[model samples]
Target: MPNYTLLTRQLEALLDDRDWLINAAQTCAFIMQQVPELNWAGFYLQRQPELLTLGPFQGKPACNPIPFSKGVCGGAARSRQTQRIDDVHAIADHIACDAASNSELVVPILRQGTLWGVLDLDSPRHGRFDEVDQAGIEALVEVFNARTDLPDFLSSH
Candidate 1:
């Protein structure tokens, strides 16, 4: 099992010094390196209303921009919640940036109870992410929310 506590602590420290984009990218890369069975890990930012622009990511080059209601990343952003899909092929509106991706997890980054962006991860193995992974990633997002400065849309009252 991944030590989420330690991971969260590391993420908090990382975010304290780095800018959001670089911190997000490095954090995703760190998770991808530490975790097994993962094929892709990165972020999708809400650059505009109903649109998520690709952010720092580790893995194959992904689609540049994804709609807020489309893929797993989009669904999470739209719902402002974490989503864990055991099989991407079974999901409607699944965007196959990489056909090899079988499972996916997306955790929304919220600030002051507003959606900002998402932390996304993809795996080649079916059912690669579960409740434990969800909790871990959620913890990471919490660390992000607490440590990083929120974007104007998320921070504004």
Candidate 2:
């Protein structure tokens, strides 16, 4: 299991700035570097009322403009909860942005009480993300929520 406490601290330290995207970018890099077996780490901002557009990420190209009705990221955004898929192939509606990604974890990013977007992580290892990871990522998302300002980003979107 990852020492998420330490990771959260590291993220908080970097999040001193007011720019939300800067913080999001740093968080993506932090997750990709600190976490093992991760093929992708990123955020998907809510571009439309029912769609998510790719935001800051540290990986290969990803599926852009994902609707709120599809995939793990979509489900998390739609439900306002975390979605941790042990095996992406087993999920009928799984979006195959990267063929090598066999598992996924999507944590909704909320501003105040409204849905901001999601913090998404993908891995080539099936079952790579468990309860431990879900908890850690969720905690990290809280750190993100508390530190970053998203009013300008959200209003302009």
Candidate 3:
């Protein structure tokens, strides 16, 4: 596994840029490269009431706009909490962006105790993400939450 602290620092540095969208895209790409076995690593931004629009992502084309009540990402956004599924097939509303994706992890980014969006990742192997990954990613989202300059891409919702 990549050093989560190192990864966090790298992400922080990259996000320091003034262009928030570019920062988000670069962060997604960097994490995709640093982490192993991940099929997707990206953001699903809250676009409107009860909706999540796909933002920066590194993977096959995803469901462009996912309703907040739909898949694992939607569930996390709806509940405003981190969600991890060992087997995507077992989840009732799993959205198969890629048929090969067997596991998923989502961490909601909260600002002022409200759901902002989610950091979502998918893996080809079942049980690929565990508590450690959940914690690390959750911490990463918190880092983003602390930033005051996060772009309005999803904030406009």
Best by TM-score: 2
TM-score of each: 0.90, 0.95, 0.91
How do these models rank on TM-score, best leading? Answer: 2, 3, 1
- Candidate order by lDDT, decreasing, is 2, 1, 3
Query: In model 3, which runs have C-alpha deviations exceeding 4 angstroms?
Result: 151-157
Residue lDDT tens for model 1, 1-157: 7888888887777776436766777788778877788999898877677888888889999996898879888899888878899999999999999999999999988766666788889999999998988998888877766666556553343
* Native RMSD of candidate 1 (Å): 2.4
Highest lDDT: which candidate? 2
Clashing pairs in 1: none
- Relative to the true structure, candidate 2 reaches a TM of 0.95
> Which parts of model 1 have CA positions greater than 4 angstroms off?
153-157
lDDT of each: 0.83, 0.91, 0.82
Q: Give the alpha carbon lDDT tens digit for every residue of 1-157 in model 2.
A: 6899999899889889878889889999999999999999999988678889999999999999899999999999999999999999998888999999999999998876788889999999999999989999999999988888786355674
Off by over 4 Å in 2: 152-157
- Residue range 1-157, candidate 3, lDDT tens digits: 7678887887777677656577668768987998889999999887677889888899999987899879899899988878899999998888988999999999887766666678899999999988888888876766666643565444563
Q: Write out the backbone clash pairs for model 2.
A: none
